[model samples]
Target chain A: MKLLESRGLLTLALAGAFLWSLTGVDWGSPLIHTGGGAAARTFFLALFPPDLSPDFLGVALAATWPTLAYAVAGMTVAVLIGIPLGILASGTVVSSPALRLPAALVSRFSLGGLRAIHELVWAVLFVAAFGLSPLAAVLALGLPYGGILGRIYAELLHDVPPEPLRALRTAGASPMRQFLYGRVPLALPDMISYTFYRFECAIRSAAIMSFVGIQGLGYQIQLSLHDLLFRQVWTLLLFMLLLVVLVDQWSSLVRRKLAA
Target chain B: MKVAAVTAPAATQLAAEGIAKSYPGVQALAPISFTVSPGERVALAGPSGSGKTTLLYLLAGLLQPDSGRLCIEGQDLTAMRPGKELARLVGMVHQQFDLVGSLPVVHNVLAGRLGQWSLASSAMSLIWPRERRLAQEALERLGIADKLNQRTSKLSGGEQQRVAIARLMVQSPRIILADEPVSSLDPALAEEMMRLLVELVEDSGKTLIASLHSPYLIKKYCSRVIGLRRGQVQFDLPAAELTEAVLDRLYDLKAERI
Candidate 1:
C-alpha cells in the first residue's frame, strides 16, 4: 500500500512538472501568421484539394533533372565517404577496444551532428558559403546523407553473425580477413538494401533542399505556391511522388533478389 | 579398404596450467590444471554451470584465464591474439550449432578455412572460383555431400551437427574443443555424433576435448573423463573408474549403477 501511494504521488508530481515546463511557450507556428488578428485561417485552407492541373506538367518536367542530379550527387558522395567510416566504426571489423572506441566516437559524433541540422538549414548554410549554385544543394544533401549512411553501415556491420568471426579469430586469420570473409558476406544483402533505401530518402531530401535557388521540383512547388497556382503545385508534388514510388518499387525488387 | 592412418604422436597437443576464472559474485573455475595429448579423446562431464564450457573456451583460446597458461602443439596461446592463426590451431563447435542460418552448408563448412586463406583469396572466392573442392571434401567426410548447397536453416538438428563436424574437418586444427556439441540432439544422434567425433580425433591424431552431460555417451566414446562440480575438478579418471558413487557425488544425485 505504501509503495503504491508513493508511486501515485510521484506520477502526479511528474505531471505537474511537465505542465509547468510548457507554461510560457508559444504554441502557434510562425508559418501561419494571421494579419489583423481576425482569426484568419487562409494557410489552413491553402493546402486544400492539393492543386492538380494539367498545365503544370511542363514546369514539373523542367525541374526533374535538377532534383535527380541533387539526389544522385548527394548519395554518391555519401556512399564514398560513409562505407569506410562505417566499417571502421563497427564492432565487426574493429573488435579491439583501442581501435573501436575512438572510431565509434568519431562516427557517432559526425553522424549525430550532420543529422541534427535539417537539410534545409544545411542548404541555407551552403547558400551563404557557396553562393546561389547547385553545389550548395549537393553539399546540403551530401553532408547529412553521408552521416546517415555511415551510421546505417555501422549497424549492418555490427549485426553479422559472431560465429564466423570467432572461427576466423581462432584460425589466426588477420582482422581484414575476418571482415572480408566473415562480416562482408553476412552483411552484404542488408547493406545493399539499406543503401538503396537511403538513396530513395536522398531523393526526397534533395527535393526539399532546393529552396535556395537550385531549380528542382521543390523550387517549382515553392514558386507555384507563391503565385497561388495550386494546380501547378500539385503537378510538381505528383511528379515528386512518382519518382518516390518508382524508387520504392525498384528497392523492393532489389531487396527481394538479395534476400532470395 | 584402407583405413585413414593416424597422423601424429601423443605429445601434449594441449596443456593448461593452473587455470582460474572469476566473475562478479561467482567463482566459475578455480586453479585447474590439465593436458590433452594428440590422438586422445577426453570428455569433461558435469551439470549446468559446472565450468565445463569455461574450460573449453580457455582451451580453444576463445577466453583468457585470469591466471593460467595455455599451450597448443607447444605454441603458447596465453600470449597469442584471437585471430586466424589461433583459429587454425583450435577448432570449436559451440552447443548452439552456431551455424549462420542464411548461409549454405558449403559456405558454412568453407568458413573454417577462411582463416587459412589470404584476404584477397577469400574475398574473391566469395563469387568467382569458389573453393568447391575444399567444401565438397569437407561435406563428403561428414557424409552430407549432397546437402552442401542447401541452406543451413533447412537442415535437421542432426544434420547441423554433421555440418559442424564437416567444418571442423575442413579446419583440421591441432586441437578440437567442442562445448555441449550434442546436448540438443536426441540420444541416438548424439551417440552417432560422438562416434564420428572420436573417430575423427583418433584418425587425425589431434587432441579432442568435449563437454557432455550424458555419462553413458562419455563412457562409450571418451577413454578419459574429467568431472567438474562447482567450478572445481571433482574427479579426473579413466572411464572405467567412473563408478556410480563418483557419478552421484558429481551430480549430487542418488547412486545408481549404469
Candidate 2:
C-alpha cells in the first residue's frame, strides 16, 4: 500500500500533468505559419551571416555597454546587501543565545521574501512604482539576486567545519572574531565562485529588463523583431551571446586565480 | 629535557569544585573537585567514554558546568563574561588541529592573538598581516618555519598538529590545556610532540594539563595523573604510584584476566 504512494507515484503524477498540458496545443492551426515561422527560419539562417554593416555593428556594440553596466551595477548592489544579510542569516556572528534565534529567523525570512518574487515581476512592480528608469531595473535585479546570494552565503558559512569555529570560541574569541578568522576564510572560495555565477545570471536578467523599456540588447532585439528585421535580431542576439561568453571566461580566470 | 620544579603559588592556576555538566539525557561529567597549581604537568587518563574531553572543555570555559565553581588565577570563570582576559590566561590545543585550510600557516598561527586585537585590526590583518614576525617566530620554534607561506590544507596531519601547537605558542597563555592533542599522530610523532609541549611548558613555568589516551605517554611526561571512569575521578595520584595493577583496575579489567 505504501509503495503506491511512493516517489515513483509522485514522478508518475508529474509526468501525467505534463502530458495533459500537451493536449492544449492547437496542432491544426498553422503552428508553423507563413509569417512567424518564416521569420524564425530567417533568424536561424542568418546566424552565419549576422549584419556586418559598420553602422549596425556599432549600434550592437554600443548596446552591449549598458547591458554590461547594468549587470555590474546591479551585482555590486546585490553583493553589498547580500554579505551583511548572509552574515546575519548564517547566525555565525551572533553568540548570545537570546538573540541568535530571532536574528537568524528574521534574516532568513527576509531573504526568502525577497527571492520569492521573480526578477521580471519585481521589474514590473518597480516600473509601475518608479516609471521606466535604470534605477528600477537595477533594483529589480539587485533585490532578487541579493536574496539568492545571501541565502547561498548563509549556507556556505553554516556548512564550514565546526571544529575550527569551536576552537576560536574556546579561545574566548568574539563571534565576529570567529567569523573573520575561522568561517570567512574557509568559505571564501565557494562564495567567490557562486557570486561570479550570479553575475552571469545578472547579465541575462538585465537584458530581459529591456521589455519594461530599459535600453539594452533585449530592447534592440524587441525593436528589430517588431520591424521584421530578423537579421538584426540575430545580430543583437549574437552580441548578447558574446557578452555571456566573455563573462564566463572572466569568471573562470578569477576562479582559477582564487584557487591558486 | 629536565622537568621543571613545582613552585608554590600564591593562588592556584585552575581550581574546580563540584564541577558537573549534563547533556540532554546523559550526565557527561559528574561533580568532581580538583586544583592544578603552577608549573605542574597533569595528565587526564581515561578510556574513550570516560569524560576526559568534557572535563577539558569545562576547564577551558568552552562549556559551562551545570553546577560548581571554576576559577583561573582567582578569577571566577562562570561569573565573568567570556572575553580575551580568559584567553590571555589559558591556551588550548585541540585534538583535530583546527586550523583553517584555505589560509597560510602564518595566518593560522597569528589567529592565536585575534582575541587580543581590536576588531578593526583583526580585519586589517587579513589583507596585511600585522604580526608576521611573531607568527614566523612561533612557527620557527615549532620547526615548521619553511612551511610558513604554504596553505594549511597542503600540510600533513603531523605538520598541522605542529601548526596548532605553534598557534598555542604564540598565544603565550599561563595555563595550557591539550585535548588528546596527539591522538591522531603515530607513536614516534606523538612522543616528539608531547616532549615539545612539555619542554615549552617547563621553559615558561606554565601549568600543563593534557588528556592522554596512552598510559605510557602520561607516565613518561606527566608528573601527576588523574584517572577518570564513568565521569568520576577513579584515582588522583603521582605518576610514580600509577602502577600496572592500578591501570588495570582503572580500566575495570579483572585481575586474573589481565
Candidate 3:
C-alpha cells in the first residue's frame, strides 16, 4: 500500500510507459502526405475571409433554420423520454425496500443500454430503417440524450437532502407525494440546468445528423468540403456555432430564472 | 369551500408498552412505557443522545420497535400501512422545519393535504395550486399570510418554523410530533413559537409531543415532561413539579458516565 502511495515510483512508472509507447512511431519516415501541408494551410486561411456573398449567405441561413428545427424537435422528444425514466431510475420514489432494488436495476440497465450506443450510430441505424425522414434524426438525438439526461436526473433526485423527504414520510405522505413535494421541487433547479446543457448538445447532435443524409447545416458543410469550397464551409460552420451559442445563452437565462 | 374547512384533529390516545429498539451497536430505547391522553401536550427532554428523537420517531410510526407494542387510538401502530391511514393518525414538524425550499410557501403549506388528494389532482395543483384559500388561511393563522407567494427557502428561520406549523395545521393529524421545533431560534423567538404552538394545539384539541433541549421552554409549553438518559426514562413529572435539583440530576454528567 505504501509503495502504491509513493509519488516518485508512480511518476517513474508513468514516464516509462510513455517512453515505451513512443517507440511504436516511425521517426525516420515522413508522416505527412504530399501536398497535405498546403491543403491544411488553405483550410486555415479560409477561416479568415468566410464566404459572405449574398447567394452563399442565403443558403447558409436556410440551412440554419432546419438545423434549429431538428434540435428543438429532438430535445422535445428527449425531455419526454427522460423525465419519466429518470423518476423510475432514481429508486427513491419506491418505498418498498423489497421492490426498489429490482425496479432500479431494470431502469438502470435500460439507461445504460441507451447511452452505450452513440447518437451517430443510432442516427445511421435510424436512417437505414426510416429512409431519410426528419423523424430519424430526431429519434437519433433523442434516444442517447434521453439516456444521458435520465442518468443525471436520477442522480439528482436521489441526492436531494433527505431531511425534507423524511419529514414528508413521517407526516404520512405516500412515496409518490414525497417525490413530488420534496424531491422534485428541491432538485428542479439543477434538473433544469442540466436539461438546458443537454439541449445545447442536442443542437450539435442534430447538425451532425446531416452526415446520415438529413438536410441541415452539416450536409451543406459536407457539400462545400467535397467541392473544396472551404470559404463556404467556414460560413456554414459559423452558423452552427451561432446556433450553439444562442441556445447556451438562452439556457443560462432560463436557469437563472429557475434558481430565483 | 369544503377544502377550507380546517377540521380540528381527532381526539386520539397514544400508548407504548415495554417498547424498545436497538441498532447495530447501540440501544436507542429500552423498555419504555407511557400513555398520552387525548388533548395532552407532552415534552420529552434530555441530552443529545438521550433517545428523545428515536422515541418520537417510534411514536410517529416512522420506525418500528424490536420488542413490545405501540398503540394509537387503541389500534396496533406497527400494523399501520404508510398511506392515508397512517397520515390521519400522525403528522410531524421536523427540527429543520422541512419546507420544500424552492417552492412557493403556499404550495409547501398545501402539501399537508396530499394524503387526501389523488395523483392527477396533486399533479395539476402544481400548475393551478388548488385550494389556495385553505393554504392562505393556515399561513394567516400563523401570522405569515402576507408571505403566501414567497419562496419558502427565502424566508427567515422564524418564518420558516411558522410555515412548518402552518403545514401541520393544514394536515390536522390526530397527533403532532415535533423534534426540536425551536432549536434554531433566539430566546425571545423560541419562547414566542412555543406559546403559539401550545395555543394552536389547545385550540384545535390535538395532541402534541415534542423533544426539546431547553427545560425552560419545555416547562413553559408542555403540561407534562418526560426526561430520559442513556435511552432510559429518568423521570416523568408535571411541569410545576420540575424543580432545580431535579433538573440538575436529569442533566448530571457524573451519573451519565455510569
Choose the strongest candidate by lDDT: 2
Query: What is the C-alpha lDDT profile of model 3 across A1-260, one tens digit per residue?
Result: 78777977889999999999999999878899789999999998999999999999999999998888888988888888788888889998777899899988988888888889999999999999998998899899888888888889999999999888887777667888888888999898999989988888888888888888998999999899999999999999999889889988998888877767
Q: Please provide, for model 1 over B14-85, each residue's C-alpha lDDT reduced to its tens digit, 9 standing for 90 to 100.
A: 778898988888889998888876677788988888999888877877778899787776678876556566
Candidate 3 Cα misplacement greater than 4 A, ranges:
A1-41, A94-99, B1-12, B253-258
Alpha-carbon deviation at A231 in model 2, angstroms: 4.0
- lDDT on C-alpha atoms for all candidate structures: 0.78, 0.87, 0.86
Residue A142 miss distance in model 3 (angstroms): 1.6
2 versus 3: better lDDT goes to = 2
Per-residue lDDT over A1-260 for candidate 1, one digit per residue giving the tens place of the 0 to 100 score: 99999999999999999999897677776645657233334533445765554555666777887898889998888887788778776755675668778878887787778878878899899999998788888888888888888888888888877876775555455677767756776787888888888888888888887566766888887887788766566667778888889888988898786566
Off by over 4 Å in 2: A1-43, A95-102, A227-229, B1-11, B252-258
Across all models, the iRMS values in order are 2.6, 1.3, 1.3
lDDT of 2 by residue, B90-154 (tens): 88989888888888888888888887889899889888998899989988888889999998889
lDDT of 3 by residue, B196-233 (tens): 77877898888889987677887778888899998999
Q: If ranked by DockQ, best first, what sequence of candidates would result?
A: 3, 2, 1
Which of 1 and 2 is ahead in DockQ? 2
